[model samples]
Target: MKKTITFAMLHFGVAFTITYLLTGSWVLGGAVALIEPAVNTVVFYFHEKAWKRAESKQLPLAA
Candidate 1:
């Protein structure tokens, strides 16, 4: 839990820093920092589902 929290903070800080560097707007940087991760989490749920489906479709090798 502690690791997860720290990683989340690191992610937000990096996101904000990069966005701020590019755009020079605190509002946009903060918004992107918050929104991108939430959206990525949702996208990741479907990404894992797709990966699982693809893995299930693979044929096993015969020894």
Candidate 2:
């Protein structure tokens, strides 16, 4: 989707900017920009799964 692509670009730019600003290395910045999002995606998937499992275990309320 266009929105996803644009947001990904925005995330990459922000990550690269902050890392580069702190470390003064484009290579490290680029690496983190790519790697952090990938790691975050995996983490997010597990986080969602955990949340779903938790929600499913919740008891229903009585009327």
lDDT per residue, candidate 2, 1-63, as tens digits?
454456667778888999999999999999999988666656666776889899999999998
Question: Against the correct fold, how does model 2 do in TM-score?
Answer: 0.68
TM-score, per-candidate, Cα-based: 0.64, 0.68
Residue pairs whose backbone atoms clash in candidate 2: none
Q: lDDT values of the candidates?
A: 0.80, 0.81
Q: Which run of 10 residues does model 2 get worst, by summed lDDT?
A: 1-10
Candidate 1 regions off by >4 Å?
Answer: 1-10, 61-63
Identify the runs in model 2 with alpha carbons over 4 angstroms from their true place.
1-10, 61-63
Look at candidate 2 and tell me the lDDT of residue 26. Answer: 95
Residue clash pairs of candidate 1: none
